[model samples]
Target: MFNIAYRMLGSVAEAEDVVQDAFLRWHGADQSKIATPPAWLTKVVTNLCLTRLSSARARREQYVGPWLPEPVPTADGALGPLETVEQRELVSLGVLVVLERLTPPERAVFVLREAFGHQHREIAEILDIDEAHSRQLHSRARRHVADARKRFPADRARHEEIVRRFLDATLRGDVKGLEQFLADDVVSWADGGGKVTAARRPIVGKAKVLRYMLGFQRRPELKEISAEIAEINGQPAWVLSWNHMTAVFVAEMEGERVAALRAILNPDKLRAVTNWRPV
Candidate 1:
């Protein structure tokens, strides 16, 4: 339940709060009347998460720049240990961003069904909706996400290989090689939330992305910008650091090339990564 909340809210502290609240509600209720304690607890927690998601969306609308999800490390920073394929996909910044397009309930339904393997009946009960309605919402959510995310059925190994090549190009400042690996329609989005210096608008097209990457390499302020391999959302990603500040950058791959790149530089958004030390 804590893990579920963490994934949904992208904040460990907030997840803990939601879990605690669920437990409190359980404690306040009569045990004899509940047939399934686990389900009841999940219901309470999911509802709390829904409320959090609602407020979070409102806040993000007023956010200074683009907004990205917080990145989480695997138990040992090794992707192999993260067992579930669905869990791995959920961590992808691209998938998370697409999830933001979903309404709160729709997102909750999708996560519960896709990540936890809950049936429609179970989801309906958790969300306090009819089973048929739950099914409809889930279907609608899946379609919308599918339309936005073209990198479905992720290939972890292929993604890792591409990321390694990208890292090599970045380290060597090979602008041409980097551009060759990006999709023509490639888009790079940075979320700094007005707190850090980042691209105020989305860098569109392969050419623009190439320019941005090269500019960063040439910038005096970014001279110290270095990248280290990190497991974000269960996929191999790069953690960008300049001096003491750090940001997580993850790519969404389409076939062998990167379709989109998400650079999360917002300090407020990086809270999840700050507490996650590689084991």
Candidate 2:
């Protein structure tokens, strides 16, 4: 239930709330009326997420900065079973960003069919739409995601090695060394939610990203920060803590290099992650 809601809304708090609402509804309903508990619960949860997405989109439109998805510690499979690279990518920071472009129904159809492997008939029943409409929605959603999705290495070991080296270079302030690991057109986005200082727009190009990262590292307030590499969304990410702020830096990899970087600095988004232990 959480995995479905998380993928649909891209907010852990919202997902949990939606799931709780579903539980309350289930408790009130007569147990004998539900022909299939899993299907009934899924339908309730999916509809709840669809309703939340409508309000969530409006909230994001008025959001202070780039509205990145809430980063969660997935090493414990808290978000669900990510047994395949495709499954993991569906919940990745970049893909979740792409999903924000989709409409509520489109996002629901896509997540249900792609992430959960539900047939069009099942998706249609869940969303209360026709099978033909479900197929159409899935097609459009798939194209939107496929076109924007970054290619990541399937080998977790290699991905971890790259992140370690990248973190080491970052801590040492080795700009030139770090440049070797970045793609030429790499872009970086920071979501501060107006609670802290962050880039209002994405930093584009390798040189620009390098400069921004170096400047961020030199911030006086962040000088005493603690940093570690941890698994987030099935990939190794840099988790930094300083003062009362916790930030997660996740890289979108293309082979051995990073094509993009997503930094989640919003206190609201990082609240659940502050005490998360690395796997």
Candidate 3:
């Protein structure tokens, strides 16, 4: 249920609320009539998410800076049992960003078919739509996401090694080391949600990204902050906190090269991640 809600809303807090609301309904429901608990729960959760998406889209439009999905610690299946790479990819920050472009119904269909392996018939029943429409929505969604994607290195060890050096370069303000890890077309995004300071827009290209990272080392307060590496949003990421301000930095890689960076500095988004102990 949390998995469905998280994929729907992209905000952990909102997902939790939706799940809580679903449970509240279940508590009041006539237990004897719920012959299939899982199906009943799924139907309720799906409908609730549909209603929430209507409002969520509005909130996102007003969101400050580049809005990023709330990062969840995934090493322990904290976001649910992501037992396969395909499952992990379904919740990736990049995929979530792409998924945001899809309409709510379309997104729901996509998640159902791709992430959960739901058939058109089951999806139609769950969404109260016919099988034909379900298939249409799924096709539309697949095109939208497929058109915008990347090929990250499948090697987790190499990916982690690159991220480690990237962080080290930032701390040392090592321009050369930073550039080496970053791809030529690297892009960086920061989400402060107007509650904190962050890049108002994406910083693109290797040079600009290098400058932005090196700038971090100039801050004396950063030296007082502790950094930890953990699997966030299904990738090795940095969780840093200083002066009550917390942020998560995760990257996209091509082979051994860092291709993109996402920094979530919004305190609201950081709430779900507060308990994440870095590996």
lDDT values, one for every candidate: 0.79, 0.88, 0.86
Give the range where candidate 2 is weakest over 10 consecutive residues by summed lDDT: 270-279
Give lDDT: candidate 3, residue 110: 92
- For all predictions, the C-alpha RMSD in Å is 2.6, 1.7, 1.8
Residue by residue across 106-151, what tens digits does model 3's lDDT show? 9999988998888999999999999999999999998888733454
Clashing pairs in 1: 91-233
2 or 3, greater by TM-score: 2
Candidate 2 to truth, TM: 0.96
User: How do the residues 17-136 of candidate 1 rate in per-residue lDDT, one tens digit apiece?
Assistant: 998998888889999999988888888899899999989988878888887776776756322335666667765667777888889899899888877789999898888899999999
Residues 99-197 of candidate 2: C-alpha lDDT, one tens digit per residue? 999999999999998888999999999988899999999999989998555476789789888989998888778988789999999999999999988
| Candidate 2 accuracy as lDDT | 0.88
**Per-residue lDDT of 85 in model 2:** 83
* Total clashes in model 1, counting residue pairs 3 or more apart in sequence or in different chains: 1
Per lDDT, what order, best first?
A: 2, 3, 1
Superposition TM-score, candidate 1 onto the true structure: 0.90
Off by over 4 Å in 1: 75-81, 147-149, 221-226
